[model samples]
Each structure stands twice: as C-alpha cells, then as structure tokens.
Target: MELACAFLARNRMEEYELLRVFFDSKVVREGLSELQIPSPLGRDVGGFQEQWAGPLCLDGILAGLIVNGGAYKRYRGPARDAKVLAGAAVEALTQNRFEDFRVDVSHVAWAPWFANVAWDHTYILTDTANAEITVLCITDTD
Candidate 1:
C-alpha cells in the first residue's frame, strides 16, 4: 500500500529512476550483492550489520535526517514525507503486507547493507525472520 505509493510518488518527482523491488526469502542465502538490484553499486561485500532493521525501523541508515538529506533535496527527489517512505520500505523488506500500511517494526531484526552513501538512498535490506530482501536505489550522474 504505502510502500508502493512511496515508490510511485518518489519516481514522479525525479528525473532519475528509483529502483524499488521485493524479493523472495530464499534470495537471502545468496547475499546482499547478489540480489539482482540493477545499480552500479560497489563490489565490496560484508558491509552489513546485524542490528534492528534499518529501513523498516527508520533507524540507522534510514533515519529521517539521512533520508531527507541534501542528496535527496538536491536531486529533487520524492516530496513525500521521510517517515512515510521509510515505513513503506519496511513493508517491502519484511514482506509485511499489512492493510494499514505501517507496521510495528520495533522488534523486527534486520541486517542491511548500504551499497552507497546514506544520502544517496541505496541499500539492500534483509529480514532476519524470513530472510526476504528488498532494495531501494536512486542514482543521478549529473
């Protein structure tokens, strides 16, 4: 619901495309970089940390300040609220199909790898419980 809306809203505002995707739980065993997200991410691996969910919980890399940083502003990215985007991302990563949109992510454990800078908004997020993965990326070469 909201996750789908966030992607749609953001894509409309920017010239660059926002790569958004949801993957099956089985993809986790292949690792973050192998998830088939179509972006020119760095080749290095093992950058992810085991902690509370990043995109879902709206903490760590997905914090409001970082999500709304200069890169997003400079790129004229989504005009949507940061929290709404983050909440939608959580739904994507965890495969939580709640009708209400935002889910309680407080206890959700996630290990996420940020393929690029936080401000660039590129990441590979994994749900520890189901091992499902989701990716969100926006790139501009100007």
Candidate 2:
C-alpha cells in the first residue's frame, strides 16, 4: 500500500482516529491505498454531513475521489470525477436504508491522483445511524 495519508477534517479528529484504526488495520490495508475522512456538511437532525475517504487500491487500479475542502491535492483526481463521486457519496448518506450500502462508480476511471485503466468502482458506505458518524470507502471493485 502507498505510504501516503489524506487530509482529514480538524473538527472531526476523534471520529477520524476511530476510522484510522479500521482503515489502517492489516485486513483493510491489504487492498486499500489511502483513506480520507470528510467533515460535517451542515446542521440537521439525523442529517449529519457525509463522511468519506478515497481508498486507493494497492494494485493501482482504483484511484480515490477527493473530498471537498481537503488539503491533500496530491491525492485528488479530476474535478469532474470528484464531483460525481461526491454527489454519489451524498446520495448514499441521504438515501441509505440499511446499515451498509455500496455506491457503484465503475464508469469513472480517473484515480484521485492520476488516470488509470477502467476498473469497477465500488464505494462502501456504513451508516452508524447515529447522525454523528458515517464511514465510506472507494475501492476498485465490490
């Protein structure tokens, strides 16, 4: 896996640390490159801002989508692709019914850092239903 770390939201430090433990584990590290944790979007009951990260694939087949306001430009993809993934992430956060869901972005080939061959994109989303935390992952495949 790449030794790079993406920028995380300062206000969400505690939540980011918890997520870091999971993303940095041996199991998750096997296939993921980098993990990004997004900041809170706005104020609403049960309407917490979406939290997401770009998880680069170890094989260089999956590039991560950059979260808005993130400071890590080195790990960001094209603006168009980023926007699309961001939109999908937001949708996942709003329309999620189950505790976990997957958003498909196979049509997007650009990695957060650079262009790569077309590969299946599956963003794994876990909703804690606490309105305070949500987990997201962008991978090469489901």
Candidate 3:
C-alpha cells in the first residue's frame, strides 16, 4: 500500500480516499469478466487488456517520470528514492510467488466524481506461475 500512498502523495490526491481491494488469484484468472469488482466503464478486464499491444516495463515507467535538464532535475534525488521504495514494495509482493510476470498499464474514462476527469492509471501485474494478479490502480488527475 505504500506505493499507492506514494502515488497519491505525488499527485496531491489527499482529498480523496483510495480503495484497495484484494482478490483470490484463481478467481481473477478464471473468470475476470464475471468478477464483481467495479470497473470504470463497467467493462471487464479484457477492455484494459486491449489498450496495450505489449507489456509495459516497470523500470521504464519509473524512469520516464524523472524530471531531467531543468530546475526540477534536482528533484531527481527524491524521485530516485521514491522509485526504490516502489520497487521494494513490488519485490515484497511478488517475491517467492512469481516464476514469471508481466506489467501493463491502461486508462479508463470514468471516475467516481464529476470533478475527477480520468482513470489516470491502471497497472496490472500478472504472475504467470500460478496466475496471480496484482493490480495497482491510480485514478487521479495526472
């Protein structure tokens, strides 16, 4: 949850509460379309799967967010620290449980509030060893 908190902090989403839900990996893998989880478009996991033609690299995602060649470049230190923390969280979550995994990011067009305009990010991490699915969803203004 620290990664979620870091994301919220970075995006200044303190006013809103993030909802974290855990599901059994087996159920998610077997019948994602039938899962009762609330989705942005009322669509199934297949909708998000269609967004990317290939898997997203987690390190690339973190690296791209760093501010470079500007006054904000100095902030890269904190950004690096944040990346380390996020990486630790991911390692802790997937360690010993994953034999193989893939990362994908997708966005949806709906939000709980009228003022919140986007489903800014949805990161799906799938552990292929046993079909475990770990999703980190961030629905905030980017």
Best candidate according to TM-score = 3
Model 3 is weakest, by summed lDDT over 10 consecutive residues, at: 12-21
User: Model 3 Cα RMSD, Å?
Assistant: 12.8
Instruction: Write the number of the candidate with greater lDDT, choosing between 1 and 3.
Output: 3
Candidate 2 residue 65 Cα shift, in angstroms, is 9.9
Per-residue alpha-carbon lDDT of candidate 3 for residues 81-138, written as tens digits (9 for 90 to 100) = 7567556666765673433555545565333321233334566665554445566655
Best by lDDT: 3
Q: How do the candidates rank by TM-score, highest first?
A: 3, 1, 2
lDDT of 3: 0.44
lDDT at 56, model 1: 38
Query: Which lDDT tens digits does candidate 1 get at residues 1-142?
Result: 2343354334331222212223222343355553353343332222332234334344333545445465435324553555566566565555563222222121111224323443333444433333333444443222
> lDDT of candidate 1?
0.38
- Candidate lDDT scores, in order, read 0.38, 0.35, 0.44
Model 1 worst lDDT window (10 residues): 100-109
Stretches of candidate 2 exceeding 4 Å from the true structure: 1-16, 34-89, 93-126, 130-142
Ranking by lDDT: 3, 1, 2
Model 2, span 4-103: residue lDDT tens: 1121222342344433454445655554444321223112211223323322221122223353322323445676675566556565464634433222
Using Cα atoms with residue i matched to residue i, what is each candidate's TM-score against the true structure? 0.35, 0.25, 0.46
